[model samples]
Target: MKVVFFGRTSNGKSSVINAMLCDKVLPSGIGHTTNCFLRVEGTDGNESFLLTEGSEERKSIKTVNQLAHALHQDELLDAGSLVCVMWPKAKCALLRDDLVLVDSPGIDVTTELDSWIDKFCLDADVFVLVANSESTLMQTEKFFFHKVNERLSSPNIFILNNRWDASASEPEYMEEVRRQHMDRCSSFLVDELGVVDRAQASDRIFFVSAKEVLQARIQKAQGMPEAGGALAEGFQARMFEFQNFERRFEECISQSAVKTKFEQHTVRAKQISEALRLIMDSVHVATQEQRIHCMETREDRQDRMEFIDKQLDLLSMDCKAKIKKITEEVERQVSNAMAEEIRRLYVLVYKNELHRHIEEGLGRNMSERCSAGITNALQNTQTEMNEGLKPLLPAPVREQVDKLVPRQCFSLSYDLACDKLCSDFQEDIGFHFSMGWTMLVNRFLGPKNTRRALMGYNDQVPRPLALTPVSTSMPPFPQGSMTQEELMVSMVTGLASLTSRTSMGIIVVGGVIWKAVGWRLIALSVGMYGLMYVYERLTWTTKAKERAFKRQFVEYASEKLQLIVSYTGSNCSHQVQQELAGSFAGLCQQVDVTRQNLEEEISDMNNKIELLDTLQSKAKLLRNKAGWLDSELNMFTQQYLHQGR
Candidate 1:
């Protein structure tokens, strides 16, 4: 805490601080002695040093006279500059208790009163106005505190009527002068400033001779007797009054420092703790609510997961059964359609155009008709199966499942190469005795028998071959077929086999015919064979050979279609099942991710709640401690006041 002294020039402001320290720590003279602000504070060790403003250099001051000389020489510094004097705490009781005394330049000598107050007086606990007893309070002195009052709230002020010892020369007017000084000072503080009441203002005002007090204290410190002098009249009374003033000043400074500095800190600390506790309580409530919300969401997700799991189980079983039933229905429809298409195969093969190969034309026509029939049957089955499975998917996943299975369950590219099937029919109407033994053997064995020998055939009819009439179970849908990978493999394998067969046939026929006949014989054989082919062509339309060719082609087509019936139906069913399962799994994965996020949020909220709990406890303890300190300070003030009384 700091106590700052302010007054006009030659009013003993420095002498007052010196008397308070019981030493001439500051320079005092007949005129302005303190040119700059001097701050005297206590230090721990016995070392006393002077530090000039804006300089770190320490000047040791051991003797009182040396201290005075040092301050006098410091007159070169501006009045606004500050110099700090560090004296041992053991030299003064007030300084030992953390009191600092600031001796400022006389207010009358400086126009920067506002600057001075802002620089030094803002933090000062008590302000001492050392006025001369020979005069009324100067306007300069009052204006300084007016500026201070403007900055601080109800600043603590004490008015000292210094040089009161001169009143001894006029003992006749002593009481009158004292009463007048007291009334005017009290009126200025209570009426003009409104800082205190009349009674408190009277207590804050004092009339004492700082020079007398300083001389007496110096004599006492040196253990010397009171100096005998003619101006010693009323010396004892003046000393007593000075001692009384010291006691009041000490009590006032102590209580003022506590109220201004320590009490303010205590009150602020209490407010901060209360505010923190309230904030922590609010956070704790919010966190608890959030945790509850997270838990509820997690539970809802768990229930959803359970429902989805049940739905998946039911969907799996229902889909399997539906697919099996659909497959059987598709197989029956395709078989009937195929049988009809095979019966009409003769229409394509028996054409007399001969512009292109008969085998190729028949193969192309048969593939188109049979593929269309099978595609229609499979498409109808797909539409029915998709309609059946639509209700099985949960509402949340229905749109995604539709996108996955878009048009149909699978693709059907039924490329029936009729040449491979119908090539068994041989043109045997012409005489073959001149041809060769090979021709004779081929005719006796017959085209059907020869076909069986060249290409393997399973004549055993497929089971469950009975054709059921098409049912209007569901509306027809657009056809889809095998995946690209499966289709590519099938096409590639078929082309490779056909290429190998063509190459081998070319090589065998060219090599054997060339070896069998010379060039002239080959030409003669070709001429005779052409004449016979024309004759055979006319007989190719005979009823017997037509029936035989048609019957053989039908048998081959029917057998191949039977195999396709089972494969196409079962493959489409499996594809539908896979599409449904994949969509369902994706939906389940999304639900699991949401549930995991909720769990993490709940855990974070729990940790935050715990942290808030700890903070609240700490704030509570801090608030309690501040309250205890405030109470203790109040108790100490009351006891100190009682003792003074």
Candidate 2:
């Protein structure tokens, strides 16, 4: 058993310990007396002291006074070190019971002394807080002991109200004062420090005059005033019977510290148990995380593939619907674009003023002009339509392909598919535009010299008509009509010769007719107005026919283009579905492989956790057994204390 004496400077902490040993083995004085921890234990008929420093050999000392001198002199020792005394004191009751007494330096003297107590003195089985009983527990006394209370268990601590001899002025008054001090200190422990039992509180508080105990022991050793003789008046009357306090202290020490060895054993075992618990908690958390990851991986492998497959089919249908709607929109855009271009051309032709020659020239080349204008207007519109259809293309196939294959391989597949779709769209547009244009000319222009403008055609005169495979193609044109180039040339010649022809014909016809009319000016003017009106009617008729032709072309082209675009869209949608399925399936297989690897790792961690659980169970059983042994030790010590009493 180990016992530590704790208190303020000059509080008689060393005096109490000296009295317990019945030997003045430690120094005590007014100012900063003992500054180092001194451990005093029993030895076999030999007295010695040793000073220990940091990692240096313990130096043996010849006398007890050397221990105090070395501390005061700061020689033969380092700061934060202590001395141990193995004295051959066979008469000491504590040494007989295997108890070692520790005299700590007065607390709160310096941070160094406090550090020494906190670091080295915490493991004592019993702590005796020795305060001078001249006054009740002071604020400093309560504070110092409160700190000690924090480090040690409450059951292992006791309060010693030392130097009770002063209150002997009136014995009855002194007794009442001692009771009040005991009660006040007991309440401080219960109310301030949460000590549970008041009875135990009162039992642990001892009021003893440590000064008187020291004096009595010294005088006895010197054999002054023979054994069993009455004492002389002054100093001898001051000898309070401190032996009762000593016996009570021995009793408390026996029951509280000596018998509770198993408690110390249990404390160590609990520390090890707590360390294992923390490690186990970490392992368990790790295992739980891995298990959750493994479960999610398995779920992804089983459920995600089926869900993606279903979504792919739904996506295909949605894309097909989107493609149909987009193509219809493209048809409308193309028709609107063609109409706008025709309106612009009409403005350009009419803005210069219409004439018979210019009207005829425009009519002759109207088919070629309409074809070129429509193609240019529709070029940008067609490109916009192609881009709009891109989102309708399925993403999963391209996305999976990119992930699983090299970039070059994915690029090859993507580019080839796009090129094929574009080529088909261009071919269909050309076929339909050519067929629509051919039908329009043969029906409205009386295509006597008509030929396909967009497709390759026989450019020679009197060429035979060629058959076309398109269902919308019209019958062959009649022969013997002016070609578009010939008509344009003839119309230009008519315009250039118009001024000379009009002057000559008017003179010849007007002279003969006016002679018949007796040279009447009014009659000749009326006939000229009539000829001019007929020429104006013919010019208006030509414009109406050109307007009719443009309307017919627009309607025909819009219908035929829609059919061709729809066919191209269906083929592209089917191809996209096939590519998507193969690539998506390959990706699912790779994910499954990763999940299997995780499952293997999770299994290994579970096995290790199982082994740790077994060890934890064994540790708990050993701790319980230690607690039971401690209970038996308490019972035995209590019976022995009662027998001694």
TM-score of each: 0.63, 0.40
lDDT of 1 at 568: 44
The candidate maximizing lDDT is 1
C-alpha local distance difference test of each model: 0.68, 0.56
- The TM-score, computed over Cα atoms with residue i paired to residue i, of candidate 1 is 0.63
Residue runs of model 2 more than 4 Å from their true location after superposition = 29-32, 55-64, 75-80, 89-93, 112-117, 170-172, 222-241, 258-260, 267-645
lDDT of 2 by residue, 162-235 (tens): 76666655676876887898888789878877754687686667777666666667777888642234333333
Single out the weakest 10-residue window by summed lDDT for candidate 2.
407-416
Model 2 scores a C-alpha lDDT of 0.56
As for candidate 1, its clashing pairs are: 410-481, 411-480, 411-481, 411-482, 412-480, 412-481
C-alpha RMSD values across all candidates: 16.7, 20.0
Candidate 1 local lDDT, 82-106, one digit each (tens): 9898989888766898888999887
